[model samples]
Target: MSEHLASIFGTEKDRVNCPFYFKIGASRPDIITPGLDSLGNPIPPKQLQQHFGDLYEDLFEELSKYGEIESLNICDNLADHMVGNVYVQFSEEEHASNAFKNLTGRFYAGRPIIVDFSPVKDFREATCRQYEENICNRGRYCNFMHLKKIGRDLRRHLFGRYRRSYRSRSRSRSRSPYRHKS
Candidate 1:
């Protein structure tokens, strides 16, 4: 298999460091179901448990073959929780990177692994760049524009509060109008 070949000819650069892990965003393992209905909706939960169990098993197996398995997480955004994304941490960084490099752009089930180094600041920025490039131009306009508007509104709101606080402090300082009586 590809894995065996990679192991035989793989370099040290293909693996993890002491603190190895990568973050996978915008994926939901919990919502995944066994099959698609006539309307393309996901099948029932019990059916998913029966069928998708093997899929989960295979995923873990693939991960274990790469290096010492530490943790594999899936983003869950049920209830009031704002579960942002999923992160898989290995014992080493190199292992994590290796897994990322190999798995990225590869498809599993119906989705592809979008591997990247963790701690990437501003995912919105990245999406904007990708949108500009017109790489994945399958959908209508993205929600980035809306989110940007929201961010601008938030900034304006914060700025208004900050200006109010600054003005209040300045007024209080001037009202004292008296130098220290030595």
Candidate 2:
């Protein structure tokens, strides 16, 4: 590490810290969770652009109607489309709180938005595989045989549970203190 960056990060650099380690709070509000990589590490801003699409703009546009915005982040990593988290820092905590109070459960781009006061949590993946399969069966993105073969391959790849969860093995990594047994 460069001396300048070292001075920025402080000396206890060997240990991994949560992305929020340098932030003010011991625990962040549900508004944001750190974006994660496939191995579940924090992702950079450039990578986060793909996941939430234009939702960030939509959010800021909505929230700015109420107050000046400071920062907005949609936390998704390089792996899947599921949102690992989101973070929005308002100019004032009161604005943040007000945004949370008014926006929670409000619909945005059709789906109801969830406003969280603590660090962001993972949003469940859509079982759109079923829909994808149906579409493939109709020969949209793929054919039935191809989908079946992929399913079979996945099953064989992940201990013979064809239609379970891609996350099954990944979730079993037993590293995070936050990992929950399903």
Candidate 3:
């Protein structure tokens, strides 16, 4: 994953012209519910899925300002090292680049977000075994996203306004601020 991210975002000296997708790390200890386990250790993965869902919605709305998003997958599984990871795929490389540039190092939920280009080209390839069977024993430890379809009506409405505002902003930027002296 690091290698793929480097290829897309490039090194300090060189950068890629366009990247297809990017991932955001918004995981934080605070996101988990405050509670202790049987051993008196702080139990993680406690109702954080709901928190992640809210984060996803906020991110989707904000990132849409840059461009059209093809897919947004938030990893709900705490198993493995992928918990609290979000992968966003954009229709264009420019959009991905913009999102990467803007979101990297930004704080979310009181934690700094880690943003990087993702090597994943297809989401279906990363499906969880337990999710498909509906018997995920790991529960929160499962390392795959269990997603429900976002309403198309909401998406359409949001994107429509975004496009209009984006166009207007571009137009305004292109116009000259100074007027010819009469």
* Clashes by residue pair, model 3: 77-142, 79-141
Error (Å) of candidate 1 at residue 1 is: 44
Clashes of 1: 11
- How do the residues 28-83 of candidate 3 rate in per-residue lDDT, one tens digit apiece? 33343223454768646534435444566788888888888877776655644455
**TM-scores for candidates 1 onward, in order:** 0.39, 0.35, 0.55
**lDDT score of residue 147 within candidate 1:** 15
For 1-182, candidate 1 gives per-residue lDDT tens digits of 87765674433223332111112123222333324675889778677544544444465568756665454443222311112233455667788878887888887657666565655233444233444455534322332211111134533543355467669877877889764442
- lDDT value, candidate 1, whole model: 0.46
Superposed by TM-score, candidate 3 places the C-alpha of residue 29 at a distance from the truth, in angstroms, of 12
How well does candidate 1 score on lDDT at residue 112?
63
Off by over 4 Å in 1: 1-38, 78-86, 120-182
TM-score of candidate 2 relative to the true fold: 0.35
Compute the lDDT of residue 116 as modeled in candidate 1: 56
Best by TM-score: 3
Per-residue C-alpha lDDT of model 2 across residues 60-167, encoded as one tens digit per residue: 567776555554544322222123335566667788888888887787646577666643232122122444445423222211111111133432533333224446
